[model samples]
Target: MKNKLLLLMCILVFTTGCKKDFLVQEPLASFSDQDFWTSEASVRAFAMGYYKERFPGFGVNDVGGVFSIRETLNDDYASVSLPGFPSQPTVSGGGWATYFSDIRKDNIFVDRVSGMGMKLGDSATYKHWVGIARFFRAMDYCDFVFDYGDVPYYNRPLTDYDTALFRPRDPATFVLDKVLEDYTYAAQNVKLDDPGTGPRGLVITRDVVDAFMSRQLLYAGTKLKYDPATSAADRVKAGVYLQAAKDAAARLISSGRYAVADNYQKLCSTIDIGATPAVNKEMILYRRYNTGEVTHAIASGNNVNTIQGNGAPKDLVDAYLCTNGMPIKTTAGVNPAYLGDQTAANQLANRDPRLTNTFRTDRFYLQYIETGYSVTGYKCYKFLDEPTQNEAYAVQSFNITDAPIIRFGEVLLNYIEAAAELADMGTYTVVQSDLDKTINVLRKRAGYTAASRLPDMKIIGNLPAVGATVYDDADRDPSVPSLIWEIRRERRLELVYEGFRENDLKRWRKINYYNTQLYPKKNLGAWITKSSVTKALILADINGNVTSPSNTATGSGYLKVSQTFRNATSGFVVDRNYLLCVPTYQIDFYGRNGSTLTQNPGW
Candidate 1:
């Protein structure tokens, strides 16, 4: 009887295993599936891992460095490679690999969540987690489609023994459909406001999802490939998605959850490293960074003397409308003398205050005075962190600032553009009230006393002539309306240093307009000196009041120094080769599986 009881006990133990609840496991190596996904905390941790997979370094050649790609694609930023500059790729290998890796991790998380059974917690938590997963999946796919075009769709992770390791590329439309499906799911299931978290604009709130949807739809609607041969229904579908995006943005604006920061200086001045809360309302979605964890060394030029020297190009500087809401040409044409002076004080004077926030002018000084770095022509002021510096590289110190991925301001603009595009289809000319709200909000942030009325066709036709009289109409393409062009121009100016211009140029098919041969010819002017006697004296004062003799002498001498000359625009013509080709290694890998992915034409 005793032996029988012992056997029975052993059987029971074998059937119902002992619970392992407190085990810590290292990721990316090996772990038991049953041991991992058993609780809400575990699931949340897995989601964080997905986010970690997507985070790139802050180095100049990393994704943070890609921030300059937009500047390069536009006529706004230029680069001079020296020691420590990472190998420059014809296409961004780091960006490509990081995004693809992000997709892989997101796929793994989605698969894991689907199979796991939740029993202990609220069902809503599980649903919210799933919604967040889908949101990330859609975001990763959107990045891939926009940058690399249609890529292989891997909704699940591959097994080691699976012979189908390689896959064929899907159509861009198919990928877009996947993005829409995920976003739609996220919008429907995710709570508008997560419980206990309050209405934090920094997190993945319902509004952000909607804004992303609008961005995606607008991108699809404008692409020429989505026309007739692709499908008659695509255009209509595009309109629908865009409309949904617009509605979502309008809802957020109405909800009063966010407002543009009060002043242009506030936008730039909020780079304080010691602040208790690093994020501001102006930031929608941003990656948080701390000192020693990651750094923007290359972009900040190793923080040499707190001067990164990553300067913005003159063409972008000229893009900002004068403070009077008139084109630069309106002012420049009236006084050619001001045309040669691109100093922050000269070029930015009487212009949109956003210009000063985005680009450093001679008038603005670095918070650290000893560096004496002034804007040579126009320089980027958006990413500088003057308060924090790595002691080793005084200029290279990594500030604990958050890098914003999306902003509400962008959503407003997206809504206005999309609604205007769809106006005739549903609403006549998209309501002027909606357009005004978007523009006026941004103008207010820039300290504009009042908003201007939308320009009519005749007013647009009279936009100051750029390049030659032949190109005047080119600048004022009435098919899209002059007001729309103005909005786009504002976006170019406001979003200059952020990583959007390159993709924006591709999507709009307007690379030819800015990247023409006439760019160099049109921009022949001497570099504007950014020195002033008062600023020089201030720079010399190490103790905040007493001027250093050396600095005072340099400041006095600089007033007499001749202005330096530098060509602010490139001569490169936008040809078929403007888009990057698939790297040879990727093509080689895909070719083994009987899949032939063609390179971009002329590449």
Candidate 2:
């Protein structure tokens, strides 16, 4: 009884696959497929299972969910203990079988729900349940396409004796087209407000459907547009998908069903964001974690005692803009608001309020000098409830903080980025009004006063401008347009540590950012003074050898805890890193079944 509703819903997935004779011998406690699909409550409960299956709020117990940690291989963090990017491929077996097993479960739901016509009551309700099934099926397929370029599309569940499941991989574009169909149907048919047998924000609504559609479409559009292997016809499809992404986000913005009205910090750290109208307005879909039922320990990882060996790197810290809405590394002189990064206090001053909200800025909790609590010194307390740091529950695996699965803040960022990307492709024009409604609205929600609010982002003479003054970032990639660069900067700052940086890089064809040679700052942490640190501060040289700070420099420099010497040459293989290799055994299975499951390019 981890979660009553989730456990109830999961009964369909777990019990439906029993032998036909087993159903004939069903006990009083067991629910056969016929008994389960007859009621509306059962249908709703079945869909609820997907919430936990896919979302998994802060994860169960001590494990971190999507929002609480930055342990992924990305530019946002630097750690000596973390593994480097794969330089070569190996037979990583049994990935597709697992994915397809979960996918077939969704297929079973879809087939049964579609055939359950008139039994669950009305036609609209029937369509809604089917839409939920398709939404999850499409989401699962999208994940498959992301990892492996071409994945076998299974629209129906195959029996154990059927060899159809071992078919060749479908075209990536074809799979995405099918996904688009699913999302379109879900967005159109899902209820705008569905009060299920649970809390308000637990069930999937039209708004949630559109929110995820916006994200997935943006990812699809950008991945196709940037990938060198994409055909010219597919590039046109990229524009189409990008337009659809913009429209999906636009629908939510125009509907006004949600707003950026919650406390930025509390939205992710509170036990119940849906407790108040004002706070829950931003939350589109959140998993509520009751203290005794489905609690987790994400807070403990961010607590005072725990040391986040994998800490936010300088690369991520420098992405935050100054309060004046200008970059710290602008070609237009120097931003006076930036106070320099010699110390944590100086670095936190005059920066975006999110920087302070995301990192531990309080001097007592600042672990920059104390190497034990944080490796990079930039400790993230974004999901920590400060008052509960010392509570008995906080130290264990039961800290009950609700995790934001989808929120208005992310939708706004997605909207602006998609709109800006459309504008970049000459299909749309981004006006000042667009900025006012989206990016500027987010800035206002980030606690900016009326007078100190960031100036509206404008495209002036093809460069990104704060009002009328254009600013250029020296570190910007030459191929990326100035406006696109700024939009990406906003996205990175808004969504950092929320499990997006890695995927963002992949979709943009910029996975080479993980290379420490091209970007040495990826391995460096906070700047510090050696004399201030009481503990033994360790660092590595260019060759990854243990070394001390330069004695001549008086021990004041970046805390370079890790040096990726090997990755300087062999990191992030451009030929094969974007898409993962299909397991060799799975390909062999297809071959054995007289089908061709070709490996991805350069795998």
Candidate 3:
């Protein structure tokens, strides 16, 4: 009887094709709304997926691509293929496509939850989930709009097979409107404080929504092409949105929910990976990388002393201000403190303490097999996980550090910059006051004694002799409105290697200014000189005595008897071609059915 029963069950399973369906399931396939998003756990899981898509790693894997491209602007690493030529490189469409894919999933979640009548516990919880989804959707759209100019906007799951599958690009303004709409919804629905008492960084809080709205409004107000096509009133609308962003930031700052970390180095190393949330007050929205998951080491390698060449560029090293909140070049002749023979200890002397914490200068060392590992140029130390973690693999070396997507400090800077720009346009003149507040806070937290006093131009006399010409007003006192330039200089320094330079340059319309062949040519000399080794010691006998020789091996291993390493400079100037061309592959794939897309000019 048992044998007969088992035979019958096997037959039924075979008829159902259960084993085949289970074995051949497509990896990319997702469940229907009916199968997913029926419970609060499922909703939380959906939120996790969105975070995962946005922050793929703590280090250099898929997440590294997003971070690396942004740092490309100010000098972290030069494009090897382009040599010394500054060019705009398109982020391969993978990030954009992945973001859209996640947005589609988020939309599906929203639709499912709205229809399922599943108890999301309470009205606040339900609205919060919806708000979170919308926030991510807005963020994803913002990324698309910033990079590609215009993209199709999808708010909900597709129902019409034909139209849904073949939607065309909307106007850039239309896309911005959609982003604003979603952010407005999120800001309205989400609570400034957590209702469910979830971990501060786990779910989208009211502060996160506000930060997103602030950033969106600032971008909309700044990008000229996205400004409304109406009359002069459009300019007023831009200012209004910018002012709103400032107000949001102001409210958050007043709430005292966040503060700058006490030690700048502690902020990057300890705060990034330390037990207990490191300074959550400043972090408006951060994606947490658990012990064994994502890490920063993968994105920017910590294996700098080895064959891995993941150090940051001289431009970034040069950006750090000396003790008195002045650019290093304002003090150190063009030689800059952190490069070449300047030992890490001396290079980091009297500089922004954050530089030492955020980057691996020649002075910092990692524990290697027997001896310590050290390198020349600084390696990005922010977001890197300590080697002790299980996630630090032999092959991958992924540092599992949580990545901050949005923070109060950034919001403060945005508010200050927006306010300053508006003040420039005759809206207000307290711009210097706004800037001082933010800079003072960061400097104080960095533990430098000089934070209490601004640098006196008379004390320093003229600017440091080297690279002074790069500053247009080299002769002008470092105070005045020319000090506003210093604000940007401070932003570049304070936020070095954090992946903001490229976008900042783009918005300022300063891409042409820095993208020229001349700056890169002048900059390449520092990079090549600093990267080359000066001497090597060899074991001479069984005794501990060693013989030393001046090594003249070039990076290519060719003997360099006389010639100094020189990088080729592109003589051509940057023009409209400086903007990246949307990848040709994307156009070809989507151009069917009257979906032709325009490429950036001069590609």
Candidate 4:
């Protein structure tokens, strides 16, 4: 009966949804049969399923996909109840339990298919399946450490999970080392590209592995290199990984196949990729969405029609460079001209094209706005496509845009940052050509000129060997070079709300980004004054209803999320918030009267 149940579950795991399929895999003959491993087609299909399940293409409302983090937590988006570091958070949804099925499926694939002979393909083709399986496992662990801190390491499927589940939490270093191991293997062995165009855009490839390794390595190396949480020994080892990150990125960059395409918008929220994948060459791996087949709600979440308002913050707005390639904050300020206009277009005027491309300006989509759903005046435009993203609508699925899961633009970012940060960590100096390869190239893509000659980074070496962090520098971060700051700023602008911001805040220890001290007093939106739209804005939901007119009704400035998160006393406790609270009950159960499941600190 137990084996029967396992067989049933295993079959279900491999059963790809005909509708949800991105790189659809045909089923093996009778999933429970041992002969499942005999066919090369079945093995390839199983590998494709890993891509589908691990980096899932989200729908309008799927956990771990579209609405995953409730974007309001980051500096970019605004929401009703501002988030605070929990004083006593309990029962953080242990990300592992939710992903155990996936890990098991991955393990089974790696274990079963690895030794079996492939009748239909050469050994090289067979290695690709192994690499794909390892990649998924590594990706799962990378995310695991990101959230829960330390979890037991499992390389093979745990058929008797009840007895084995209580294995003690491993140190984060051990888990990250394992992650590096898997990613390393995958990078070397994964197929250069998919077998053909049908799979080329979606299947796991060497470039995808390299890009992800660069990303994961960059994160792991940064956290170890700087964060006070890391031990001195770990800090010493940080360079090894940081250098590895640089190398991984360099391998892909040297290949020269990927480039920052002319249109950054095409890399996101495009229903166009399915029809013309060639145009989105910059996309190393993007989740495909067909109207009836696989779809996501990214459009609804960003566009006016479905109304997931999610206003982009003023600070974020200010991050966009002016047309002359200068920071907007340098020339623009919270004064009468810039802030008082109360019109979205005026607010965005003279800023970078990305600002216009990314945000919905003064043009009221319907005079209908909601306070709870978004930042008051502003709305996001990054993941939105016009004509199709409208209310008249594209399909019942509501979104058919192929979301870019990984892009070469990010790899360039990972490379440049790892090098810059490494330079700070040691004697290695980051020069202008480095900027040319990454940041400056990105600037050109955003349609900026060369006089943008980037600034040189300086090491703000004020951090103590061991203690609470303090900054003598103005920005309150480790005072690195002017160039490094610009690199950081560029990343913030380019990847705003694409799901990297929140993680950026955590790894860089920029928790203060969400804290109130950064803002003058409130989390201000674009400047607004009393006018027809002001009256409308006051009494407007997305449907243009006038129910309750509250918040900035005066002839004043921009919109705002409340002044809670930034306020020190607004229930956001520092240090304690760095990690989330794991449920005490689970800790207790997993502990099982012994010290196996150590909880995250301050939880």
Candidate 5:
């Protein structure tokens, strides 16, 4: 039997958020802590639960996760108040302990499946389930290292009398190496398609393992390469992880299992979005939200007529390439069709098609569900389905649009970035073929025509060019290479508002990108004609000075709410802010156990 009931069990648990640690998690009770290996079906059900735990999709009712959530901590969003950056440690743990709960489950599953009733070592089914469990354990550790730098590593479920439960933190390099090993096992051993339903694109498969591995390995590689705290010997291992990431992505590309098959808008806002070949063509793995079964508030939050009290900032908006496939701020003035940013229409004119697809062009002025408005003049509709925006079905907690967990689109990006970082590390040179396979494919899918496709990103001597002329963005950070800078810009535009900017900036060791003093555009919003809009507008310049439109002058300026909100805030303290501080409770708990948990530097 295919055990279709497992899917229903999976959907019912969709509302359970990711718990922070193994210490607090209750072991599976219904399936039994004993005889857990009685059948493959039960094992499969246990694995399915990890999906809901780690991948929250669009999240529970009225609370957003993964999709279209406000990533205001990064440069992409601007609102009335600047999102607070991590400045100090909390006496209570900051969710750092929640990962272990799942980690413990992973450990128990692996331990039992191998040593207990399912000791069939060579069986493909046995390998598949164990591989899935370990893959999740790696994912848990990836999240751990990414946030807390160094953390205690565990490979088995601990008992109350276990002395190893009080083990000290392992070096990040050591921990990440273990993560790499687990992902490698999953990638090599997991089945290519679900044994239950072949190529359904909704279950754990070898492709999903490789895709996630590429993302995590790239993060591991970049953190080691960029973080100043990394030891010299550990930094040498960065190239190894980068090479592995590139290899993993290359495997998926060569396998021909997926493609950039759907258009930008269709891929993002569809209902019942997985299972069908047409919809799952681009998605390697996705969470399907059935109406009245498992629903989320992401679409409702992005409703055009709803008051979404946040917006894409000018910093992100300006990153969009002009229609002519050049930056709007090029030194040579290449894109003549580029209208100035005095108003929403003018700003969007002749820009990249993604800009129009992402932000609601017509709703830039205003509309209503009992008087709705965007905090910034620009409103994001990337996740909004226009047909359902005004319906009862699209309101809070009732939205049924599917959430893409891992798609071919993100893997393509991961491939290009890892390849570029490897090139920068002097491991190898990036050729034009690399760009064609990765970045160019994404551009073509983003509404570009054969005649007007973005000029292929050139590597050797030439940076990104339009037609025959090479140009540089006027606002690019001088520390970055022009070629690398252009690649980063493409990533910024392609993945905006998808909760990637903060991590992207961190991995590149460019957290200062959010510092208002360095990039004032972070605090600026969409340009508007102050007199034409009905709302009382507060406009300000980069210096935090409130400027009133002169009586003789046409009232016009950008919304500056974030400028006032962030006026006195110190943004992105480089030394202490890259990694989060280990909560005081964690340290105290270790001390009480007669073990010491060292805090991150400068906390």
Candidate 6:
């Protein structure tokens, strides 16, 4: 590699010769901005930058920092947030414009790609690069819509004369419409068969755009229906967007290209997302990592020695169904076995295979290093330390597993959730046929071939599946409709650590999940007991936590409330915290002449 720097100096002489003084310098090894956009190759080159900055896959260069493993902020599993705390930031605090800046990059690309004095391409040319730019533009707004409610929407590229940059924030509904437009264009024009980016060019595709659109539409539609931000008239159209989400998912399904892989555990395990992406067709868009060139530290974090005991709590573990396709604790047969089984191993064995695959059970715990990583007592075995990187001689931070961005399974959940909501609103009826293509497929994939996982799909043969089964959980919050709650539960179970929970809670407006009044207080862990021979690794910290021996011991050791997560937040303040505060500069810049970027409600 070689480096070159070129500086252009226009020296204006104060003398008589000043009129002729000018700079005529050629840029060395750099494309001139004035001419760069004239060619298709150059325009495509510009779009590649967007992928590097925002397209999340395996840690491009940073290990263990893969994008989808962002569950620390969610409720499914509790882990300490350091450098950044494990909980929500203060109301006055903001995430800065790095995200906004990334959005701006997309804005500029879309403006230039569409504005460059020529059609993106001829009739024969599908303008694939332009479609990519539009896809990214939509994604940027989607992130903005979720993070900071209403944001200043941009279309034209930024310039010194740009006055809109100083305009007030647009309504979230308006921004969502624009996002939908871009996604729609990407879905229509991005050549479905043109292939995508990364080494395998497997990252983005027209189908991937639709899958993400499905998630965003579901999120936006659900929030509009549940949140008070919309008017009664606006609320009436909730089913429209909800149906759009289902439609996007339906398009992907009818295509027959994406589906859940038979083996769910290995999707993110030792086989590696990059090597088995074809096998794991569920992942619509993913980040690929090269072994030495672009590695991440997920392997280091998964190592038993450095693994920070980020275990799945009992609350999540019990959500898994028994092999018989029934909720483990709901039926007397399985629930009793779970409650009576003295050892943790025996209890785990009685539950769903996903539960065992996601966490370290009895026999599996024997391999835990002396240094305990599972702070929750029940350690997470979800994204396992791959055999290639977990070796004694390997660098833990150098693992090369691809990280998921959007998966087909997520689209399936989005489909059913939207369908159920639409049915409740009387906009559409979700019949058994929808279940056959969506939920039942995942059920069969999870190895419940012998039994139907969700009996509602099985038993509602001729009955109206929508209103037939009423979920009457006394423990469930009254604000949540039973059907919606069940849909949320299925989503929670299917996409646990892949980082869907925090947003799920936000969209459903169930901030009370963090409200101590409703749930067991924060920092609670699984039950354990002393003198129980569960695993050899149980001896590691089994004796130390036995400090309050006289208090009691139930299983392998004891449940220790985490101080790390406890001190992280005062609380996830309802309403205000549901959305993040807008980036400060956007507010300042757009706040000129009675124009405020507008802080999120309560912030």
Q: Relative to the true structure, how large is the alpha-carbon lDDT of every model?
A: 0.53, 0.77, 0.54, 0.64, 0.75, 0.61
lDDT of 1 by residue, 104-125 (tens): 7788777777666464266666
User: Candidate 2 on 81-158: residue-level lDDT in tens?
Assistant: 545556566465555666888899989999989989998789999888888899999888888887777788889989
Which run of 10 residues does model 5 get worst, by summed lDDT?
A: 363-372
Q: Candidates ranked by lDDT, best first?
A: 2, 5, 4, 6, 3, 1
* CA lDDT, candidate 1, residue 452: 27
Q: How many pairs in model 2 have backbone atoms within 3 A of each other, for residues 3 or more apart or on separate chains, i.e. clashes?
A: 0
Clashing pairs in 5: 20-97, 20-98, 20-99, 21-97, 21-98, 21-99, 21-100, 21-101, 22-100, 22-101
What is the Cα-based TM-score of model 6? 0.83
Per-residue CA lDDT of model 5 for 436-534, tens digit only, reads: 899888877734565445556555554666556678888788888787888888788777777778888888887777666656677777665555333
Q: Give each model's clash number.
A: 9, 0, 15, 18, 10, 17
Model 5: how far residue 189 lies from native, Å: 0.3
Identify the leading candidate in terms of lDDT.
Answer: 2
Task: Pick the winner on lDDT between candidates 4 and 5.
Answer: 5
TM-score of each model, paired residue for residue = 0.71, 0.90, 0.71, 0.80, 0.89, 0.83
* Per-residue lDDT of model 3, residues 371-485, tens digit only: 3232223455554444642333422434444556676667767776677667655786653346446665665663545543334221112122112333323322333355446
Candidate 5 vs candidate 6, TM-score winner? 5
> How much is 197 displaced in model 2, in angstroms?
3.4
Which wins on TM-score, candidate 3 or candidate 4? 4
285 Cα displacement, candidate 1 (Å): 2.4
C-alpha positional error of residue 216 in candidate 3 after TM-score superposition, expressed in Å? 4.0
lDDT of 5 at 551: 38
